[model samples]
Structure formats: C-alpha cells, structure tokens
Target: MKKPSTDVLYQEESTYVDMLLRKSWSMRIAETVAFVLGMMILAQFFPSNDTTFKVLAFAIAIAVVGLAPFLYKATMRPVYKLTKTHLIVSISGKETSYPLSEVEQVYEGRHFYRLGGKKESLMVSRQFLSHLNERLFYYHKGNKRR
Candidate 1:
C-alpha cells in the first residue's frame, strides 16, 4: 500500500510566531527612541554631576524600554500547523501534535478548531484551516492504506 501524500497548512500566525521569536523592528526602534528620551528626562530631573550616575541612568532607561516589547512578543506568539497526517500546536515553546486518525471529531470551538475523542481535546487556531470544501474533497479522496 502506498502512503498518502502529505501537505502542511499554515496561516500568518505561524509567520507572526516566527517574527515574535525573532524581534519586532518597529518596536525596537520605538524602544530605542523612548529610552533616549527617558534618559534625557532623567538626567534633567536628577541633576547628576557624576558621569557614572548618568551612565547608569541611561543604561536603566534602555533596559526598561527594551524589555517591554521582548516580553510582549514572547507572551503573545501564536503557533499552529496542520498537515495531512497531523496537527501541530504550539505556544511559548510548548508544543504538541495529533494524528488525523486519532481525531474522532473536529469542529469550531470558540476561537479555534477543536479536535477530540479518546479522552483529550486538542485546540488549534482556525487560521490554519485550508479551504473547507477543498480540504474535505482531498481528505475524503485519499485512500486508506491497510
């Protein structure tokens, strides 16, 4: 018996997840600008005569500004993939995959597609869904290998 051909389905969320893992250039720019402004303001208010104190203040400002977007992206990345044989779901580095044959049922559940049966449910963002009619047609068209 020949195995069915497999294809992966991914939505923009996967790319966004990859981008989040990388970095946001716009956010980097914003942070740099904000940090510089913040350091200038701090120096003005603190009236620091010592060069060391001024440097420390600037360092602190940069750290605070830079930390925000990094944390935001880390916490909010969306990751999901649908393949011919399995569905991969991931967020914040935690991931899991489910075989299609193991999926006893699949349907819309809140903000995602839920696949469940055999005691556990897997949540997948609907964005990874292929065209419903096309997916159905191909999925049903495949012959099961015995």
Candidate 2:
C-alpha cells in the first residue's frame, strides 16, 4: 500500500551462526592454549624416542589451530542490511530480499530474531528488534481488516 523506504534503518552484517560461535577474546586465548596442549599431550603416546616426531606433531597442531577459524568463517551465513521496508538475507554471496509487510511470525531470541514469512525465514540482530516489532505489528494489524 505504501512505497518501501530506501533509507537503511539498522544494518548489521554479522551472522546468526557467528553470534552463536563467537567467543570472548580471553576465552579464545584459553581455548587455543588448551588445543595446543592437548595435541602435544596426545603426541606423547606415539612411543617414539626421536624428537622429530614430537616436532611433527607440534606442526600439525599449529596448522589445525590456525585453520579452524578460517574454516568456520567460510560457512557463516551473513545477515545483510535491515531497512525500514526490507530485510536482506545472504548465504554464501547471494542476497534475497524479504518484505516487512509479508512478515507472518517473529521468533524472538536473546541475541537474534528469527523472522518468518510464508515460505522462508531469516535471522537478524537484536538491534532491529524495536523496528521489527513496530513494523510487524502494523503490518499484521492492517492485514486483519481483509
């Protein structure tokens, strides 16, 4: 009934999966230390006297530790722009736009909201909660008359 606003209201690029996996900086340090230590300890069971075996194990451990974040980040589905009229969902690199007027269900969460339409759903940051609620409320209210 109304023209969709083009101005971006609240935009966040972080993904729902990332929010779940992201740890505090200090916690990350601890985990990394633990992994390295665990790998080195496991290396102890090799039953070999040569120091090269221990060095090889250390190298493998470091490689695994370094590559882990990159591996996880590659699969993160990013939630793109949140505008007054549209929410963009991005998986890989493709973007899909969902109209706010079509929103049918809102699954609110602690840090994110799962906005569901008739055929699809997308996760968004809590920063858009107020705007989403106001818009969804009015959208549903208007639909009730028909």
**How much lDDT does each candidate structure score?**
0.52, 0.56
Please, what is the TM-score per model? 0.36, 0.45
Best by lDDT: 2
Which ranges in model 2 have alpha carbons more than 4 Å from their true place?
1-4, 15-18, 21-72, 75-77, 106-123, 141-146
Model 2: residue 66 alpha-carbon error in angstroms: 13
Writing each residue's lDDT as its tens digit, candidate 1 over 78-104 gives: 465666666555656776666555443
In model 1, what lDDT does residue 46 have?
Answer: 71
Q: How far is candidate 1 from the true structure (C-alpha RMSD, Å)?
A: 10.9
Predicted candidate 2 versus true structure: per-residue lDDT over 26-60, tens digit per residue: 43575577677766776677654668767867776
Which ten-residue region of model 2 has the weakest summed lDDT? 110-119
